[model samples]
Target: MSIPFLAGAVSKLFLQFGCSEVRVEGLPAFVERLKGDRGVLTIANHISVVDEPTMWGVLPISTFYDQRTVRWTLGASDMMFNNTFDSWFFTKGQIIETFRGKGIYQKAIDTARAKLDEGRWIHIFPEGKIKQDTLTELRRFKWGVSRMLMESKGGRGEEAPLIIPIWIKGFEEVMNEEREFPRFLPRTGKKVTVIIGEPINDAIEPLLAEYQRKFPHPWVPITYGRDVQEDLKEEPPQLAEMRSKIAEAMRQELMKLGQRVPEVEAREPTKIEWNW
Candidate 1:
């Protein structure tokens, strides 16, 4: 009745070396929901390049044995796929490369959409990049996440993905972007905490319903350089506006969980409370 010893040795190793005290809340529900055959979208605040993997330390080591419980995440092509060795490693890690400036209509997103259609779990750092100022504010989320969230329906009778928001505290101290020399090694003895939200499917369903009501058409993928950079020039006005709103809404949702982070960082986490 036990999971294999080496199931999550990698995350266990990090948990041993990276932080001193680690506390997590609401993960059991997150893990349980993944058992169903529905697309799952999980979003988290990105404090460092390794936050996603590093934060995995909290999951029960046995959780790694079941592919159903794992998540597929997007990685920056420029950094994660810089070389053949790096590309091969990231690919095996269940990460897909997303170009920084490219629009949401790229191959990586297409792959993510395809995976979601297959009922796979897709995690995204909607901020699109690492933000060192997580204690003060979270940068605005990019539209790519919204595109994945809304267009996932594809008018194919596939159910929309279940949405989950997570907030992590303390990765910034482990891998400070400004650290000098021996950058590859993570700083030790830091305190870390993770809070997972229950499914916010109800809140997102309204937006998806509104989006579907407005579009009522199949999605077609396209990309134009500057236009993509600007307000998705090729997209319909309603679409462009809605994507921005959905991304912002997710950001705000995580912000609700973030209220406890500052207190945690100051060594005083309050009685945990979140309003979904």
Candidate 2:
């Protein structure tokens, strides 16, 4: 069986056992807005490890715009691409393994650009890492998305990619990073809600301007690294400034989209124990 079909099948099974109900809002309108051969970039918040499979189950699999629009997503190389089975499964799901610390991330970006050139949808989690807090609390976004947008504009000009913001809720409740198996028979069935916001082609400028107004600084362009605990003391000032600005912009936009859903009381923290 093909990888996509396998993934779809597994996702469907998970939906049956893991999720009690799936609610998708604003998908029809977002799908209707897709036109021509323009590239689409979908951004969403990361809450749980099962978020990807949940998305695969809920989103329209093969019927986007009456054509099979290819989908591509980014996965951590060390986390998802190290084992043979994992590599195969993720690859079949169109996930491109990306090495976080290595300079190889540029390769992933190039691959994504190539796919976008072919009018495919690229999905990314701008938060870099999943948030362990409440559903309403969004972590700061990474600068990689802004860099992707800038690169796409430079390459595609007027046909630059369309950015779609999506907010997902309830995946964390089903299975968080701390759990290997989901609670199949919880008191309340798992319910996941996905809300897609309007598309925006001209987001960078406004987002950046708002970020600057909120946090004034003399900015410069810098490569934003993935690790939140990294010491920036040794980095060049300009690069650090630039990366911070871009990350701030992306975070603001995501926060705006996240506000569409009402905040819920913080779920009990997940406890993890390492056996090593």
Candidate 3:
């Protein structure tokens, strides 16, 4: 499916769900700052499954930017790219699948790096899972994004990638994990807000330190291989440590964005009345 077409469809779906008011902050200026072939990595809080498509629909339309720049998102293979239809849709939607158990997870990182090298945009949910509990609280972020950023910088030489932190509120009220689809008619006074923070160009060490201070327990390291022994062999002690630090740092950055914004109200959906 064409991106422009998908964007249109998602926009309509968002409207049908009573996404009446959408407010974007700090994204237009960031778009204007884009020069020739500069790569962008967007890190956002995952509130619902609709978060990805909502972002796709909202960003271009809200910013009045060109839709031709390919937007790549890293998604779980089992969840987002399970079947042929989903695979096809997500592929066209620019989702790069990350098969968790499969040894080829690195391939996804490499693919993202390649896209970034070509001056495209990549979106990652560093939190790794949807926060169905609350919009204010964020889950511990996984380390894939940090590793990806490091790899991208190494491949692109002097062209450093920009990391944009985004905070989206009201998606949980629109559609949570309990419902597969967004409500046909939204609750009264429901609004979706997407707040894009300024670009982060600093080193990852400080952010990583902050994350470690908050969550003292170390991140469970990821091992890649067909079997346990092979997995152990593939991941050395030092490399695993580095990856964990980077992942936490990325998570911290996203959590910081969430902190800056006001907490989204946790509302229980009321029973819908269908006029027969």
Candidate 4:
């Protein structure tokens, strides 16, 4: 399948913006992994806006094209969603919004199921927001990812979409600010690296057991009026500790599958948590 002309055009935009080389490797393995008639759900670390595009450049556009897997993206904010000029790449990449109201949660569930059925490649940041002023700790993984996967497994009766965790390094420097506004600053001498991890099954028995031991109750009929921020704040310290474990597991897995990065100068963050 020939790449859409826009792909090449977009490739140059990254180059023109001080992206010296968008290096791509492990494509053969990734292509082979996808050729088996399975959709993919990539959970990528959201550091900078450049993170996804760099991964897009490294990925085989032709394979993703043939699969008809629209690269779905979940933005961290309304502003991030609204400011995006590129909607041609995602199924509904505009805003990662979910409808609210009476009995509407099921609709959101159904939307996730339908996306998988369409054989689309969905991208989510498990953190749900970018980590600014902190690099050492990953925010807890939102239950939405686990919920979507569990629902998909039960609905399809086949292996769910291949879950790929991508660890992106160096974008924090390139974009270097909490929000998007600071990203456009004059380009400094910085480089970025994106490491793609191998796929995993979200419904694995061990993972479910792990969740049970941690969250205890899987489903509850809670009212909608409660603030979600308060709910998230209620998470136990165990959850945060467990989250770091999961993120490190994924990071290590990514490092194993990715290339040995060349020795490059990295701008260490003020606060750093070494994953290795």
The best candidate in terms of lDDT: 1
Kindly indicate the candidate among 3 and 4 with the higher lDDT: 3
Model with the higher lDDT, candidate 1 or 2: 1
Model 3: per-residue Cα lDDT at residue 128? 74
In candidate 4, what are the lDDT values of residues 1-276, reduced to their tens digit? 233324533533453355543343344576566555566777766676556554464544444345353365554333443444533333233224443222223444446656765565667776666675655456666655555554554223445677776666666776766546555662444555555555755424345446456665434335432444444455565544443455445444444443344422232322111111
Residue-level lDDT tens digits of model 1 in 167-261: 98778888889988999877888877888887777666777778888887745744333337453545677888878778888888888877866
Q: Put down candidate 2 lDDT per residue, 1-276, tens digits, no spaces.
A: 566655655665666555666666676576555544777888889987767755655545443223335467888889888889999888877888787874312567668767776677888888887786876667767656655654454222336667778888887776655664444432237776777887754655554444344435422225443343343554445444655665565566767887866532133222111111
The Cα error of candidate 2 at residue 87, in Å, is 2.8
Better of 1 and 2 by TM-score: 1
Q: Candidates' lDDT values, in order?
A: 0.74, 0.62, 0.63, 0.51
Assess every candidate by TM-score.
0.86, 0.73, 0.74, 0.63
TM-score of model 2 (CA atoms): 0.73
After superposition, which runs of candidate 4 have C-alpha atoms over 4 Å from their true positions?
1-8, 11-17, 21-25, 61-67, 80-96, 99-109, 132-136, 154-157, 178-189, 202-205, 208-276
Where's the lowest-lDDT run of ten residues in candidate 4?
A: 267-276
Task: Using TM-score as the measure, name the better of candidate 2 and candidate 3.
Answer: 3
Q: Distance from true position, residue 102, model 2, in Å?
A: 1.8
Return the top candidate by TM-score. 1
Steric collisions counted per model = 0, 2, 1, 1
TM-score of 4: 0.63
Per residue, candidate 3 scores C-alpha lDDT tens digits across 1-276 of 475455645554564455655555665566555444678887889887667676544444433234335467788888888799998887776778887755423678779877777787888887777887877777766656765665565322445577778888877777655654445533434577777887766756354444444444432336543432355565556555666666666666677877755532233222221111
